[model samples]
Target: MKLLINIVRWVARFLGIFLFLFFVWFAIEIGSPDLDMMSNQEVKLFIGNLIMLMGLIVVWKFEFIGCVLLIGGYIFFSLVNYSFWIGPIFPIFMIIGILHLFCWLADVFRIAKKISFSTRLFLK
Candidate 1:
């Protein structure tokens, strides 16, 4: 189980890295947007994308926080765009966030179990 959890965590990390690079390349190809001329929706989309990217980068150090940022950013983007089914990319990122979440949870539980076991041993 621990091995499986580690595998999932590593997979999530790699996916996050790949997605981050892909987005960077995509943004470079698309060129920068004119902030002054962008509509409110466009601005929101830009911010959402920024948040998602930041999450991906931060996830390397903080899994739980990063997953929250990633999932929240994607949801914000979907809500602002009024299209939850925009494409597979957003959903795939969301899945990656979920995977990170589960890994974090597993680590948390494992730590808690060890602490409790030690406490019980001390008590006995």
Candidate 2:
């Protein structure tokens, strides 16, 4: 169980970083397209990527905030495009959210165990 938890946490982290870099690559590929000419899709792409990047960046120190932002971005895009949410991407987001919650629980349990162990030692 511990190993699975660690794997999930690491995979989520990797995905977050990968997605951030992929967004940068995508933005660069457009090569200074006219902002006024850009469509809603393009605008959403840029904004969503920026938000996700910010969320991922701070996730290291603030897990809940980061995960919520990450999942929220997914939800927002799903609603706007109405494409990914129905497809495989939905499962990916669901996995990430569940993994995040599990990671939080694992940390809390670990901390509680340590505190209990220390208290027991002190009492002895």
Candidate 3:
């Protein structure tokens, strides 16, 4: 159980880092020579979304914030002429975000309860 928890933590951290880096890379790519390359933007957008989702899955807390940023980023990316996953698939992300939110809330409360119990015990 301990090992599994550690593994989950590591995976979440890895996903967060990768998602952040991808966002950076996406910004740089669009800011560079490929600025006018509309043809390939959809591909980039899909990849970005995929990376973001992985991060979302891995993150065990503050998922709502993460998801909001992800959605906002995707919107901005779209405005700049970035093609999304499969035929206007922006809603797909929304659906995932909603699901993630529920799971995140559960985890957050569970963590909070555990911490509260431990703190109470320690105080006693």
lDDT ranking from best to worst? Answer: 1, 2, 3
Residue clash pairs of candidate 3? none
Error of 3 at 66 (Å): 5.1
- What tens digits encode model 1's per-residue C-alpha lDDT throughout 22-100? 9989989999889999999999999998999999988889889999998999899999999987687877778888999
Error of 2 at 111 (Å): 1.3
Q: Please, what are the lDDT tens digits per residue for candidate 2 over residues 59-124?
A: 777887777776677767666666665465344544565567679889889889999999999999
Model 2, C-alpha of 119: deviation from truth (Å): 4.3
Candidate 2 lDDT for residue 10: 91
- Model 1, position 117, has a per-residue lDDT of 98
Clashes in model 1: which pairs?
A: none
Q: In each prediction, how many residue pairs overlap at the backbone (N, C-alpha, C within less than 3 A)?
A: 0, 0, 0
Of candidates 2 and 1, the better by lDDT: 1
Stretches > 4 Å off in candidate 3: 1-34, 37-66, 75-88
Per-residue C-alpha lDDT of model 3 across residues 1-124, encoded as one tens digit per residue = 4455455445545545655566568767776344355466665665556555554554356666766655565565555454445353454544445555555566677799999999999999
Which prediction has more favorable lDDT, 1 or 3?
1
| Structural RMSD, model 2 | 3.4
Taking all chains together, the TM-score of candidate 2 against the true structure is: 0.67
| Cα-based lDDT at residue 83, candidate 2 | 63
Global lDDT of each candidate: 0.91, 0.71, 0.56
